[model samples]
Target: MAFYDDGSFHQATGVSRETLDKLRAYAALLEKWQRSINLVSSATLPELWRRHFADSAQLAPLIGTETSTLRCVDLGSGAGFPGLVLAIMGIGQWTLIDSDRRKLTFLQEAARITRTSVTLLPARLEQVTGLTADIVTARACASLETLLGYATPLLEPSGKALFLKGRDAAREIDEARKTWNFEVRRIPSQTDPEASIVEIRNVSST
Candidate 1:
């Protein structure tokens, strides 16, 4: 309810009432299920709107209205942050990849409830095969270099990546630059100004 209104979430993603309602339902479900399963950081639950939902939704702009039609993959989809957010934003296709079946179950249910089209894959990102996407995203997935290793093989040429990272972003980028040649920019995060987003494209290995 009040959550959808906070965190620059609606502003970042331009969420419609239909989608916003679904995300609201998702929040409720997350709170309910989280009591049993470790979906999100418990300490972050009190501020779930700004901490989780809004943080996830802020990446919607990177999807761009044009890219919304492209196939996308969300690796290590723990709590379906930007991945599920992207689904609500009307991405043509989305696959939530994770090693945990339980999380996949939640993702699938979230997709169904939200009426957002999504595919759930219960497997390690490195082992998933025979698929490629126009965009690959991961929030709290892994280090940038390791993330590239997991995401690059599945990305189509001209594909882009949106990763969420904290204060150590520059160090992560430096490590990523050791083996990857891509244009990476850090955008100020709407949730926390001290935080930033790592946007990577023109992916190449050094």
Candidate 2:
């Protein structure tokens, strides 16, 4: 589709032609609704494929398709990139958490338009109380240490935190380790090799 460019996403997410069609339909809806809400950057619309779709689709590698349905939450899911995408990727239950009511409104509308099954939490990330999920995903939200403060409390003892990060990810992980006792995995990011997906887990008091 003209809106998408990343070929790796189709492969990585195991999205067949039909699923891609659904995603395209969702993108179209998002693009239309984003006009009044600012769900995503205007500059990103042209390169939606490589920039948005693929960036979010990269999570499939860490959590494979055909796996049983599991619940996950996206903290500060500003525009519902990864959380909404993850829902379409077959997560049984998904939650999009953000403080801005307007963004969550757009996310809720996007879910309605995309028919994505997800819950919306309109509250500050730090105040929302919930169970640790199978996986917790956040993107472009905060630094590793700050993110740890927000995400760690939402993760189960064995649950993993999949955070999308850029070049400074490794250093951030190093900094976060000073207070968080968790195993970290850095996987190559499809959007930018210099970027990484930091999977954080084992968040227990040392």
Off by over 4 Å in 2: 1-12, 66-68
TM-score of each: 0.92, 0.90
Model 2, 1-206: lDDT tens per residue? 23245355576556777667767777787788778878788998888877788888778768666544677888899878788887876654788889999888877777776677788988887797855688888899988888888877787776888999999997898888787788888898877768999988787554
How well is each residue in 99-161 modelled by candidate 1, as lDDT tens digits?
988888888888778778888888887798888988888888889999999888988888888
Model 2, residue 60: C-alpha shift (Å): 1.2
- Give lDDT for model 2: 0.79
Candidate 1 regions with alpha-carbon error over 4 angstroms: 1-13
TM-score of 1: 0.92
